[model samples]
Target: MIYSIFTALSWGKDLTHLFKRIEESKIALAIFSGKYAQSKWCLNELAKMKTLAEKNKLKVIPIFYKVKVDDVRHQKGEFGHNFWKLARTSSGEEIKQWKEALEFVSYKMGLTLCENRYST
Candidate 1:
């Protein structure tokens, strides 16, 4: 079963709680929006999910929402711009983990929903 942990739905949860949910779940839906790369928490969560998935403890599914897979994988376009901003203040190890996580998640089976698909 695919158990999704939407960040929007987890507004009040603590870090330990969030990590616990990810650890206990079978699948996690990581939605990569235009500004996703800008948030430190989101990137860390993705990194943690990547770590677990690598150990065969969890499965991560990426959702490219109004973003491109290649952009996310290679940190290109707006996503890259935001990531670079975060990278400047982040340690090399953090950037490495985040980048590896993004690259790993980008290659997994997932869905892409462009802006044209929905109106805001």
Candidate 2:
């Protein structure tokens, strides 16, 4: 089964409900793109996934979609630019958490889809 924020109808459900679903799921796929780090909601979901992986042994598969793994791991290039832009309006603690989550996922072994894959 696939769970996507855009497709999921979560009118009254809180993030805890989403996290709980993540925790219960057998596998979680995190598709990291250029603007992924710019959204607080995305960062929070990733952070929760990381925590669940460590504590509950939930498996997380990171997929780099047209983005460099190094850029995500180190927060450099486009990912860095977008993240910093979001950081401007975020608290230090929030930024720290997002950074930590990015760092954690970056180190994991994942598939990377380069620009050529999507090019015509």
Candidate 3:
């Protein structure tokens, strides 16, 4: 089974269409992870999706991305560089938000690093 964790923007843009495809695919499950999914507009849409999925007995998991400091700097190059720019220009509140987003991405990247390091 192929699981998908599409972003919030992607969901907003084509959720109905994508969900339809997913239903047709008859996959085991579909997972989505994003912060925007928490917004009021998105939440309502999510509810509709949930209802539809439940009606068809489809499995859909939504994961919220949380951030951490220790892992944020792991990808210290292009991607990190862009984040750095945002970090520099962001207001205190925005920085706080970005930090959270970065943490999630960084932690996943860290896991990738660990796997590669231990691979023989």
Candidate 4:
């Protein structure tokens, strides 16, 4: 069976639904794109995944798609800019959690899909 928050019918449900799904998942893939940090939901999910992975309850595999791992980790360049934009509108504690999550993913063994994958 396949399940993902990405496939959720509606987020109108309690946020716990998302947390439950994350807990139920054995493994999770966090895809980091240019605008990834711009979304609070995405950051929150990554935070959850990071927390579970820390406890050995879940395995997280990060995918850096056209975004540098350091950029996500340190919040640099465009990714950082967007993250700061989100931060300005978010709580300090939440931002700290998201930053930790990004840092965790950057050090993990995972896939980095850069541009020109189809090229020589």
For 1-120, candidate 2 gives per-residue lDDT tens digits of: 334542165435778777766666666778889998787778888888788777756677789998888899888889889989999999999888888888887887778888677311
**How do the residues 1-120 of candidate 3 rate in per-residue lDDT, one tens digit apiece?**
222433332465755665554454332221222233223333333444444445765544433223222423342444345455555654676455444433433333222223124210
> For model 3, what is the alpha-carbon lDDT of residue 14?
59
lDDT of each: 0.87, 0.78, 0.39, 0.83
Estimated TM-score for each candidate: 0.88, 0.83, 0.30, 0.88
- If both were scored by TM-score, which would come out higher, candidate 2 or candidate 3? 2
Model 1 per-residue lDDT tens digits across residues 44-109? 899999999999999888899988899999999999999999999999999999999999999998
How close to the true structure is residue 35 of candidate 2, measured as C-alpha lDDT? 90
Q: Assess the local accuracy of residue 94 in candidate 4 as a C-alpha lDDT between 0 and 100.
A: 99
Q: In model 2, what lDDT does residue 60 have?
A: 73
Clashing pairs in 1: none
Clashes counted in candidate 4 amount to 0
Tell me the TM-score of model 4.
Answer: 0.88
Once fitted onto the true fold, the runs of candidate 3 whose alpha carbons sit more than 4 angstroms away are 1-5, 8-71, 104-120
The pairs that clash in candidate 4 are none
